[model samples]
Target: MSWIYLDNNATSKIDPAVLESMLPYLQESYGNASSVQHRMGREANQAIEVARQQVANKLSCRTNEIFFVSGATEGINMVLRGVAEAYRRKGQHIITCRTEHKAVLSTCAILEKRGVEITYLPVDEHGQIDLQLLEDSIRADTILVSIMAANNESGVIHPVDEIAALCRRKDVLYFCDATQYVGKQDLNLETTPIDILTFSAHKFHGPKGVGILYIRRKSKPIQIPALISGGKQEQGLRGGTLQVANIVGCGKALDIAKQQPHIRNYRDLLEREVLARIPQTFVHGSKAKRLDNTSFIAFRHIKSAELMTSLPDVALSTGSACASGLLDPSHVLKAMQVSDEDAFSSVRFSLSKFTEQSEISSAIDELVHTVEQIRTLSPVWKLFKDGLID
Candidate 1:
């Protein structure tokens, strides 16, 4: 059985072109980037610099603005810890969302223990933050506002620019977790007034263990006590020997993402075909302005995990991969006010530029069969037939 990988949001497979670019670094130029005496070190440093430039080009920022970290999770931690430590005198409060990735939530939780107050802004039914509520949430004690550009599970895009503008006006720092949006959308730092941006390489077909953080040049940088401190790397913000090969791979992957076909048509095709075949299924999140490569759907009366387990050939998820172990309903849906029934029945299908229409058709066929089988055994459906489910 051929497996269909629809879980691009969890992590993308490394593109062949990126792998080829990384082979030289992994095999021949394994050297400490901080070492200045050796040729290997210089070569590694050069490769890393090139990668930095590529990332900068993609985000429309200068090379100096981009700092490499382990992954998006670390990047988010850096921004939060940095600001809370650096600007403690300025404020003791921050703003974020309940539906944010665990990385953001846990980091904030740590800060809260350290005496920082956080306001978790709520979302509308379509998983959109109320801009006015966000604006009101900003207090004189607010030091930062961290929000994701697109939700990992629902594929809902936030009004990041507007939020950034509010933060800018309030003289508070704005950070964006663009891990899921950067590769799929046209990101330009010039227009987006976010003070800091975080992204993971693996989300964009690059290797794991590599991520990026964009710190605006003009923004006042708060110094965070380093989490991994040893050497003077990442401009002393994150100190350690850099992973040169993964950086190179990330650059190549960004280039590929830039050149890949627009995902709108393919995503629409998948949505139309899948929904047409499975009429009882309901799409989650916004009907418009979502990530073009993602579609979240719920099969009536079917548990997401149960459906997923039945389709061995399809790769998918119930929500954020980090939250996969939890049996509880998705916090994202709850934040969006999704009903308990809808949350349990949902599955997230995220496509990539590499996904083919044939794969979508196959996925739809599998889903239809699975849902049919589940419905047959569903006591609720049986009750509905007997007019007892009302």
Candidate 2:
């Protein structure tokens, strides 16, 4: 069976362009970016800077503002720990959502143990944060408010601009976890008022193990203690030898995405066509303001994992990559108050710039057949007056 990959959200396949960009760095140009005396080091540094420029241009920010880290998980840890430790003298409170990725939640859990109070904001049925509640949650001791731009599970784009503005007005720092949104959507950080934003390269067709944290120069640097110490790498925030090749590839991938300006329209067609053919299936997020390349849908009476297994030709996910191997209901879905059945039946079909219309059509056909097959065997369906089994 020819497999169709629809799980771009978990981690995307490296694009040919990105892979090509990394060849010299991975082989002949291999050198520690920190080495200042050797030509090899200089070459690696040059490549790293070029990649930084690529990411900066995509984000509409200064290259220096982009700090490279291990990946989105590491980036979130750096920001959360940095802010909590550095500004702990000023405030002891932090706010985040119940639907945040495990990285963020785990970091918060650690902070809570260290005496930092945290508020997990609730989400609506569509997995959107309540702006009014968010505002109300911020207090004199609230030092930071970290929220995701696009949900990894539901594909719901949060009202980040509004949240950013609110944080600005209240003198609280705002951080956006855009790991799932970057490269898939247009981001103008200059006008956005987001104090900091985090993205991972693997989410956008680049190599894994590289993530970027965009820190607004004007914003007060959250005086957090460093998580990784030694070498003073990554501006002393994250210390380690930088992966120059992966960083270079990440930049190339962003540049490739930038050239494809019609990603929104392309993804809209996939959602429209898929929903048209399967009416009982519905998208998870607010359709109008989501990442153009993502769709999280529920297949009525069918389990997402079983459906995925039935169609060996297609690859997709029930939720985020970090949570995919487990059998629990998605935390994002539970936060949105989705029933256990609906949560179990949901799958995330994330497309990419390279995804063709024919591929989506074939996947949809296979998906329909798989759902029918599963429904026929479901004991729940046997109880129905009309078993619409195919």
Query: TM-scores of the models, in the given order?
Result: 0.96, 0.93
Q: Pick the candidate with the highest lDDT.
A: 1
lDDT of 2 by residue, 280-328 (tens): 6788875436677778888777788788888887888888888768878
RMSD of each: 1.5, 2.4
Tens-place lDDT digits, model 1, residues 282-307: 77874647888888887766788889
Provide the lowest-lDDT 10-residue window in model 2: 381-390
For model 1, name the residue pairs that clash. none
The most accurate candidate by TM-score is 1
Clashes (backbone N, CA, C under 3 Å), per candidate, total 0, 3
